[model samples]
Target: MSEIATSEAAHPAHLQHHFDSLQEQSQVASLGMWVFLVTEILFFGGMFTSYLVYRSTYPDAFAIASKHTVILIGAVNTAVLITSSLTMALAVFASSEGNRKSTVNFLTATWVLGFTFLVLKGIEYTIDFHEHLVPGAGFQMAGTNPGHAELFFSLYFIMTGIHALHMIIGLSVLLVILYMARRGDFSPEYHSPVEVMGLYWHFVDIIWIFLFPLLYLIDRHR
Candidate 1:
């Protein structure tokens, strides 16, 4: 239609040349992000499957290992991540509303919270190291199931280590977004980057949601 054509002709700076309109560009970006997320899910899925297999085989050892985890630290990090997700959502919302200052503020808050989560995770890792829970030489778990307990720690490190890597990458992405936001790069008509980053952040947060209960709360009811 002529109206659509006219709108396309007024394309925002963010619109790529390959895309005919901003809406189309945004849709494509969203689809791409979703596809990437699917791959991420599959990647983590393999780890989760391994965990389930081992956990079923060694439920008692797994429970004992889980008991050794720092529950308070895990709980605190969960809260921190959840709060960061909220700030991320607000950042996306602010970008969509063309509120530059608000966008920067929210993104900065999200970044800080994310950093806090990582710091807490580092503290937990230090405790794990001192407790000899690192899944290799110097590893120490008592009782008759030390081997199975080692397996539990193995999976725990792989899972949480991968999650921490993701957090690091997410923090880097936030830095870029924050810089762009400060430069007034996003607007009501063009905020795909913010939106996609928000999606990634939320996905990471959801992973932690699953992880917290699995890794830290397994033996709590007992």
Candidate 2:
């Protein structure tokens, strides 16, 4: 514990005097990070499991439906998400270094990248909608396996919908943290909000990572 304290606290302000040592703070932060990760896993886990069930049941429908999705768009979005994750980590690193300017720059970059991902997602959905790929919105498929196609698309929308909801919530939280960073509220000693937000942002990226392969990779088996 003393070792942990020595490593984390470069100054008194960084180590909460009330907490006895930096080790305690680090331990608490690590614990909280793990708990949050569990919830994230559970969230995406449900989606992944559901997708497998449907894919198993409607193999051909799943394959054909996947073709309708813009694989290139999904791939580009994945790359964008990866860049956001990088910026988020860099922002956290900036906070640790107490480089307020760098921290703000990184945060702003991350926020912009995240929004770009959303915009790309919107365009993808638009394409899906125009082609009648959207489920429950006058969705259609003709010949061969229209019934199974609907089932595949239904699962696609539900999973992606939940993921998009998470991204919006994450963006809101990130904006709040961004505001705080601008106010000079975060520092090496006090950056809980940024750290937590980083956890959330990373989790969202991971969810999309899975989503990309599941939705886009079904065709590879053929």
Listed in order, each prediction's TM-score against the native is: 0.94, 0.88
Candidate 2 structure quality by residue, lDDT tens digits, 72-183: 9899999999999999999999987888999999999999999999899899989988998776658888654877888888888888888888889988988889888989
Judged by TM-score, which candidate is best? Answer: 1
Model 2 is weakest, by summed lDDT over 10 consecutive residues, at 1-10
Worst 10 residues of 1 by lDDT: 1-10
For candidate 2, give the lDDT of residue 187: 70
Residue 105 miss distance in model 1 (angstroms)? 0.4
Name the lDDT value of residue 207 in candidate 2: 87
Give every collision pair in model 1: none
Off by over 4 Å in 2: 1-18
